[model samples]
Target: MKRVINFWSLLGFISVSAFLATEIAVVAAAVVWGISSLFGLAMVPTIALGILVGVPSLYGMVKATILAFQAETDPENN
Candidate 1:
C-alpha cells in the first residue's frame, strides 16, 4: 500500500518540535554557563562555552526534523 503523510500536520509538528528543541537547548546552555561560572570561569568565556553546546543542539534539532519528515505516516493514525 502507498503510505501518505499530511503536509499540514508535518509542518505543525516540526514547528512545535523545533521550538521545544530550542527551548531545551537554551536551558541546557544556561546550565552549562552557570556551572562554568561556579567553577571560576570568567563571564565572557562561559557565554562562549554555552554557544558551543547550543550550536550543536540546534544542529541536532535540524537533523531530527529532517528525519522525522521522512517517516512513513500510518493511515490508521490519521
Candidate 2:
C-alpha cells in the first residue's frame, strides 16, 4: 500500500542519488586529472573540470525533478 510505495520510492531515490554521485565523482576526477596534465594547475583545473562534467548532470537532474513535481501536482493525478 501507501507505506510500501513510499518505501520503494525512498529506496529508488537513494539508489539513484548514490549512482549519480559516483558517476559525477569519477567523471570529475578524470576530467580534473586530464586538465591538470594539460595545464599544470591542479586546483583551477579541477574546479573547471568539475563544473564541465557536473553541469549537464545537474541540468538533467533539475529537469527530471521539476517534471516529477509537476506530475505530482497535476490535478488529473488527483
Q: Each model's C-alpha lDDT?
A: 0.71, 0.62
Candidate 1: which stretches are off by over 4 Å? 1-8, 19-23, 72-78
Tens-digit lDDT string for candidate 1 (1-78) = 544667875776677677767776778777886789689888787888788877887787777666555552445445
Q: Which residue pairs show backbone clashes in model 1?
A: none
**Per-residue lDDT of 70 in model 1:** 53
* Cα shift from native, residue 38, model 2 (Å): 2.3
Q: Candidate 1 versus the native: TM-score?
A: 0.58
Model 1 CA lDDT for position 78 = 53
Candidate 2 — which residues are off by over 4 angstroms? 1-5, 42-78
TM-scores of the candidates in the order shown:
0.58, 0.49
**Candidate 1: minimum summed lDDT over ten consecutive residues — where?**
69-78
The sequence of per-residue lDDT tens digits that candidate 2 reaches over residues 1-76 is 1222354455555566566566756776687677777888777767877777778767766665555545444445
- On lDDT, the candidate that comes out on top is 1
